[model samples]
Target: MDHHSSHFTQAFIHLDRLTHNMRLLQGLVGIRPLWPAIKANAYGHGAQIVGRHLVGLGYKTFCVAHVSEAIDLADAGLKATFIVLSATLPENSPYLVAYPCEPVVCTVEMVESLAGEAARTGKTISAHLKIDTGMGRVGIHPDAVADFLERCRNYPNVSIKGMMSHFPMADEADKSFSQQQIAQFHRTREVARSYGIRTFHFANSAAIFDLPDAHSDAVRPGISVYGLKPSHVMSNPQVDALQPVLEWKTRITFLKEVPAGTGLSYGHAFRTDRPSLIATIPLGYGDGMSRLLSNKLELLIGGVRCPQVGRICMDQCLVDVTALRGRVKLGDSVVIVGRQGREEITVDDLAQQLGTINYEIVTNIAGRVPRIPVGPSMAGASTESVGDDGTLKTLTER
Candidate 1:
């Protein structure tokens, strides 16, 4: 029954926070459909789990960055309308069409290929046309929007379900560039409507929280669904109340007393400043704990902050627990990226110390760390039964 004995670190996902965040997003973009972006394994919180939880919360649509991700969701029996936010090759078009997922058409060649395929199969292929409104990525040029729509308009099997664009500066507090992107999107949508094309969207997570006017018909919320703020620039009075859903944790495997001046971990980057009670945790860079966090990060042990005292190894790291006010022992719980009582350690906090972004912080966590989905079923209990092969099992089944 001791989950930590399995030698796997765990990322606990708070499903209630996920649902709450979606509701908050709905409140922000009233009546506009919210597509929870679950790309990159739902930002490393486990995609299938997050997707299923969101779908249960009445989310009708979900978005990912590639076709494979959509396939994964489909294989998991997700019945929501899934949208692939990136374009697919002509060869891959058939598979995309075959699967119950929609592709975001970004180029004329892709549009032509998909249209041709849909016509041949005698099935309506739903797609969203992506317009390049200054993101300078995969999207049709603004000037070519009309011609592109024209080519697909007569195609019998291709249905332009929606039109969308990415904002280059929507994360900024300064709304000038974001507003311009929105304006350009509106202009492009108007051009499409001149040809009688409606159902357009341009806002993403940033716009969903910061710019209400940018929410055209729907908003694709990526980061906010995980309960993190959109970006640092948008991290102001508006998003101060959002709760982070993902919690990175592990158990102390062993405790040892080290003499002062003892060299620790790789390259001797750290030496004990005094006689230290070091706790060795079975988590390291291989478990998605960043190598850059060595000696710079702190973990919450028994609700007390303990500094990482050595170079973060590939499979283990040492935390100095000498200053702890209470007795620390082996098998005690440790928190690397979540709240411990009134104290909290966040991906943003780690990113700030590591000089990276929150996205990289969570995504880089190695797959070895098993994500344990927590909800009302767990009743805030940290203990859960995981399989012998490191898969998490339901406690009731155990």
Candidate 2:
């Protein structure tokens, strides 16, 4: 057995926190089946790991963006309902039939293709109809709901398991557009029910938090499970109780004293105003630390806030540590994306600084950062563990 040192930079995934967030969503949705979105590799948190953990915690359904993602979870022994939330292609039909995953049918052609494959295989194909109530990205139009359902109703091997739509702006404090979308969904549901279809769904993470009335049969919660709100306006009162599960961090690689006016990093974007001790951390845009954070973000070093001093490079960034009260040294840990004592750097904080959303902040973290599973010993464990080179290492060996 290889014994790696405890000083490697790694992402610390709080599994318990993930469960807690899921439970919180469940409590909020109240009896509406929770289909945790595991797409985009569980929002770059390792979909297989997060999916397995959630399945163990009694989450019976999962959502992904593609057929391959669904197959990955299935390969990971996820026996729960795996639904692909995007349109499927004809080329993917063979795998779709081979796997137990259900596809979200968005067009008449897709429905016919699935029906054909199911007939050939002598298997009942399960699918959810995506109704384009408002968001024009995917799904069949609401007006075509009756015709599409009627056309596919005669397919012997086709089973309509669900119906869903996406809300464009449920996160806004203004609910007028959201209400219109909901009304459209209701209209579509009525059309589907004319042919005896009952499984209806439309609320995503934002909708789940903002529009409780739209939790018809199930809720596909993506960001909320990771302990993030869809928008800042929707964060208070409704989703203030959610816990963030992913905590990003890295260790300080080395520390050096620079005289006043010393230019730091490439292009010399940052220059020392006064004599200062600059600590170089081994995570940059390559590891998902945004380049936009250059000189715009702060890292929690020893529970103290240290501002980034230069342009963030592909693999490293410099943080000013002169003002920090504690003794700064090489190999000391730094919290790039989580809490350190009373100093907490939230994704929202990063988003606000970077002029983006919390989703991009967390999901943009590069795949190289090893996500360490935080177990029951979470109380004593740092929100994140820092490695020697500042590359995140998993607490549990993968």
Candidate 3:
């Protein structure tokens, strides 16, 4: 079977914009290592593509959510140090030891298990000690940092190279809780320092913008690295400079004219007030376009903003393209989240409509939609051109 057949939707991963965002964040941290979070499949932007590009850009370290994710990237030849971010069980110690993964530790059993695995494999496993400064989620209590460090000394094979914490409300307009967290982290920093822990990382995407003091020894930036603000309330105006790296696009698959008073789609959720030209695009809730967005969203066709009418289906949605009746055609490019001429629809717009955050909007993009890497680096490489001009270019295999 031809896997590429009938696949109309794509998320264009702009490597240039990704590099720009990384450079912008790096400038703020200044020589401090910036460990870009490639977890959740690089926030659903295709981890393989994003990891490869970042590796080429001289990023020697990356943060992933799990040891398996790190293994997958490493197996794909992404040479880098993988810092596993989430808390895991003693059962996962073997995989962690087998791979180049440094997991964040919050429990004694996990540490002992890792030590056992490292001893058995004759390899030293470097790990980070997570302190629950204020997040109230994972990690040990702040007061227990010294004891944890002391206990960790028993496991010679399990080296605690770093100490870290997370901020719960760093993106909010109010910084009181974050400030307290940072203060608490400072006290724990002394403990880590006494224990000879060299790296102490605490800054995330929002903290990178609003909490300069929390920049610690290294920074782990997630959303900001993908050119997205942590929240609308970040204090730094420089957050606005981060360029979006992903653009979702599809093509007109089918079209027809409907007379006035005609009810369209399932449940008749929408009815034509006047004669309208309806265009079908191969995108739906199944493709990560929420069904709640039915008749509540707009797509770009021939640089014109066309209202998406009717109920969104599992594999298709209808766009009322009457405005572009004379200009649009079958296979014409449709901008789902990107610029078309002077008009644009952003991920933020979709999030607002869905009563969600930009992170959800981007990360929720379905897996089937192929991510095509683009930018100056990809200029001469094979790629498909599905533009509004209706010119079809053959898609090159990755």
Candidate 2 RMSD to the real structure? 3.9
> Each candidate: how many clashes?
2, 14, 0
- Model 2 lDDT tens row, 157-192: 778877889988888899998899888888778778
Where does model 2 exceed 4 Å of error? 1-7, 377-398
lDDT of 3 by residue, 127-152 (tens): 99999977888999989988888999
Instruction: Say which candidate scores most in TM-score.
Output: 3
TM-score of each: 0.92, 0.91, 0.94
Query: Which candidate order results from sorting by lDDT in descending order?
Result: 3, 1, 2
Q: What is the Å distance of residue 246 in model 1 from its true position?
A: 1.0
lDDT of 1 by residue, 1-398 (tens): 54543664778878778777888888888888888898888898777677777777778688988888887678757777778897678887786777777789977677778878877777778889898888887888889988888878776577787888988788877889888888888878888887666788888888887888789988899888888876877844657667798998999998888899999988989998788888899888888887877888899998999999778988999999998725888889999998888898888999889887788888776666766767742132233432333333444322
Question: Candidate 3: which stretches are off by over 4 Å?
Answer: 378-398
Higher-ranked by TM-score: 1 or 3: 3
Worst 10 residues of 3 by lDDT: 384-393
lDDT of 1: 0.80
